[model samples]
Target: MSPKIHFISGLPRSGSTLLAALLRQNPRFHASMSTPVGSLVNRMLEAMSEDNEYSVFISPEQKRAMISGIFSAYYQPQAEKAVIFDTNRLWCSKLSLIKELFPGAKVICCVRNVAWIMDSIERLVRKNSFDVSQLFNNPTERATVYTRTEALSQGGRLVGFAYNALKEAFYSEESERLLLVDYDLLAQNPEKVLSLFYQFLEEEPFQHDFENVQYDEPEFDNRLNLKGLHKVRSKVELQQRQTILPPDLFIQFNGLSFWTTPSNSLANLIVAQPK
Candidate 1:
């Protein structure tokens, strides 16, 4: 039998990579940074869509099987593991399709304040110093923190798409299968968060070493010219620091943490206490 599949998704710079690193410590689990399976599944859907010349020859059941086969084959090497946690930001947006394919699957969404998320990205851009990021189209878009954040927050862009997709799943009819894990909460108290996380999945708990966690994708980061983009510290704890974003720019995203509004969230959430 194939291992149970769950997903790690949500905002960038939000701890999904760290969560994956911690989860993989479990002998029965397999987890990692973003995998190619998500993109492959999307491409498969496009190929089977009406735009394809042979779409008339494909049936819905066949298409489903083909898509399902992607996961089974991609994780075949880890077939011995009892569970697999696939990481991808786009998964939140496709909750309906996810449910259709894996009815028991759950999505663990790692979230943080939008302002901090922008700050984290800006920090990365400044840290690389010499390399230009492919995240933006051209030099004009990367000219300033304001321009960069603006470009990133466009409805179709990176941060914006994930935020919107999270909101979509947060309030969708399938929200029950989702769990929103705050980045601060995970960083500060991973054990507590993992307890809630396991309860949400109804899976038995496995002890995770919060102090010695490890995960990094240097090649992937270098490819984007965003070094340390997916690096996790050897220890799990929040670092105290002031924002590099200009005051005005940081404040622009003040009220975007919609998950804080209890009335708007239907999914289970594990968040930090208000300061």
Candidate 2:
């Protein structure tokens, strides 16, 4: 049997990277930011679904297993005993498929206010003074706050697509399989929040050194003009950050999160696996 694995998917810049970095501190865990599992599945479906001669030769079952084979191949390098956490935003959209592929797998979604999610991306873009971000794939297009806001929320970007997909998973029959970890809660009280997460995953406690965590992907960051995009803090404590976005602009996406609403029964749930 393949080794156990779960998924880390949620709003970009909402701490998924930090969560993965922390999880990897456990020698028994294998975790990383935005792994290719989701993308591989998407690419395979795109190629095989075409109405061509090759399409007739492949069965649906074969395709499914092949998609899973990608995961098996990617994680084959890890110790056979390690539990994996594959991170990707597209995982949010494939709820039914993921449930079938990894029956007991839980998706940990790091969330902040929608407005702030947008704000975080914008802040990074602004930080790269000379290098325009390839975030939207238009490096030369210097986007303003208003224009960027529209573009992010309207298209294939993280905040828009994944946010919608999360809502779908939250309301599905598999809603119990999703955990929404708020950025503020994770920032201010990681121990409390992560305890719930570990409990949900049914993992034994690891003596995580919150005081010293290090992660960076400078090459990947440079490709996108985000030099320090993947940098993680040495300490897990919440540091004060005043949003560069205006109050009016930031408020636009404040209430977009369902977790903060009264009807959100799954808010901050530690585990979504069935008992």
Worst 10 residues of 1 by lDDT: 266-275
Q: Once superposed on the true structure, which residue ranges of model 2 sit more than 4 Å away at CA?
A: 139-141, 264-275
List pairs with backbone clashes in candidate 1.
Answer: none
Writing each residue's lDDT as its tens digit, candidate 2 over 1-275 gives 56697888878888999998888898888888787778888888887886566898899899888988888888889846558899998777787888888898888887777877877888788889788767664532356777677777864775688788777777777777788887777777778887888888898978788889888888899998888888898888766778888888887877677755555445345322211
Distance from true position, residue 139, model 1, in Å?
Answer: 0.9
Best by TM-score: 1
Write one digit per residue (lDDT tens) for candidate 1, span 165-267: 9989998999988899999989988899999898899899988998998899999989999999988899999999999989998889866888887675579
Model 1 lDDT, residue 136, Cα: 97
Instruction: Give all TM-scores, in the order shown.
Output: 0.98, 0.92
Which residue segments of model 1 deviate by more than 4 Å? 273-275
